[model samples]
Target chain A: MNRFKKGHISVAVVCAVLGFMISLQFRISMEQKASLPYQRLEELSSRLLDVERERDKLQEKLSALEEAAEKGEANSLSDQKASEILRQRAGLVAMEGPGVIVLIDDSRLKSKAGDNQNLYIIHDDDLLRVVNELRAAGAEVISINGQRIIATSEIRCAGPTLSVNNVRSAPPYEIHAIGDAATLENALKMRGGVMETLAVWGIQLEIQASENVEVPAYKGTTQYQYAKPAGGGAS
Target chain B: MISAVCGLIIGLVLGAFCPLIIPVAYSKLFSVALLACLDSVFGGYRSVLEDKFDNTIFISGFFTNALLAAFLVYVGDHLSIDLYYVALLTFGFRIFQNLAIIRRYFLKKH
Candidate 1:
């Protein structure tokens, strides 16, 4: 009887261990499923889409309110005009007018006689120089490959590709600037200008003046965390 | 058999209530250990049916097999090779073989 009881106890202990392990494994797998990186990314993107939709709805409502206020009170007209000017300066409104489109592409031709192959590829610095020249020529709004050039926007190289406003853009960069087309084109194509520098490196450059050019509003939020109105009383 | 069932139920309840958390890095170790424990249990069951069950061997084998399997997984990870699959296959095969023996023993008796 004692031998039979001992054997049963041993079996019971082993079974307990097995049961514990199985339950632990199931729980750990459940935890891992909850913490997957792809799952988190999916959740965040859905939230971002919802936030973007809310922002668009708010913007439409603001426009409607502004239009109604403009018709109701003449005193509120100045306030609405001031807000419009601020939005335009902040790159919040899509602007369209006479401008210039500069198309820069990586050279397809192989290096000829003692030329470095690296120079044929368009670099971030080249794009920055072109943008600087445009801004210097009084270009009001600028965009590179559909990414609006806001004050906080960054353009840099990201391993074989270029990042404009943190968005990857390959060769054949289309830089559009909304302003005086004649001045912008002249600034880029002048002797010893951006065009000449690019041509020397075997980079392709095409500058065209357009009668009407649309520069999209900056899609990223422009929330200021530190900086406030000069007096700091909430203007 | 009734005692074993009761133990399993108690273990399951304990596991459910226990707040112990295993890191994601040691999940592979846990899996190999589980397989090793399962193989040991099956082996114990077969030995019991054959009237050759040794309590000391069963208890020692249960812990040692689980530890050795986890050690193998750790070493395999350090070597950047998947040796857990080999351990898994061997242990899995043994469990099935032991189960077959236990089934036949019961079948012949009844």
Candidate 2:
């Protein structure tokens, strides 16, 4: 009886600790499921989308006004050519040329237990780095998973997926660029370059050079809210 | 038994509100350790019912089993092995077995 009573004290202590751990794990998993920062990000992202839509409508109106000016004040042939070149440079027109198509996917290695599963997944920075390398290699126009890269476009993380110009896309990210195909492919495959770095994590990358790769036009708005023409009458 | 139940309830409430910041990496280890503790408690309870309880063994088993389970998980993480499942299965099976024995003992006594 005495031994049993003594054992109860030890049992009570162990039970207390067990209960504590159970509750603690429960709270932590719950907190992760509905974190405050994640909630805030979702709210802000929706608001950004709404504002982008508003900006798109304004852009259309501004383009209509520009068209009217072109018709009323007959512009010279050289001026029209220059404006067309500018539109192409601004990624407003779809571009097609000989370039490379890079297909990058998550690491093929089986994620170990208790290891950070995020390490095996593709990240926004990986896509950003690949885009930057392509640009440096003289890519004329680039599109990631059909979303064109623009001057004002943002490539960022939105939870498990990547948000490019406020549009979410998942992996196996396919990047298409229109430029000198050889140079683009060489840039990615350079020693210690983006491809090699990604290979460290077993991220699969396949670069295929094609004679005709289509880069779509930037569909997002480019309305400048604050900045105007520097000379005030350049147009 | 009553003190054990009351202590468990109080501990659960206290832990829930304690605001302890556990790292995301160690959450898995914590779960394995918790399972080990649970297994130890059930085993100890069974021994007490059998009238063969040993206080020293109970105390030591509780700590060692929890630590060993957590260690296995940690090693598994480093070695890229799923040894966590091994610890999980072992403790999970032990918990049920102990419960079954305790249930049989109660029935026999009655």
lDDT measured at residue A162 in model 1 versus the true structure, 0 to 100: 89
lDDT of each: 0.89, 0.90
Chain A vs. true chain A, TM-score per model, equals 0.64, 0.65
Clashing pairs in 2: none
Interface CA RMSD, all predictions: 1.2, 1.4
Worst 10 residues of 2 chain A by lDDT: A70-79
**Which ranges of candidate 1 are over 4 A from the true structure?**
A1-8, A34-56, A59-235
lDDT of 1 by residue, B1-110 (tens): 79889878877877777888788799889999999998998898788788897888998999999999999889999999898899999999998899889889989999
TM-score of each: 0.51, 0.50
Per-residue lDDT over A85-197 for candidate 2, one digit per residue giving the tens place of the 0 to 100 score: 99998999999989999999999998889988887788988888999999999998999999988888888888988898899998889999999999999999999999999
Quote fnat for model 1.
Answer: 0.68
Per-residue lDDT tens digits for candidate 1, residues A104-157, read 999877888897877889988999999999999999999999999988999999
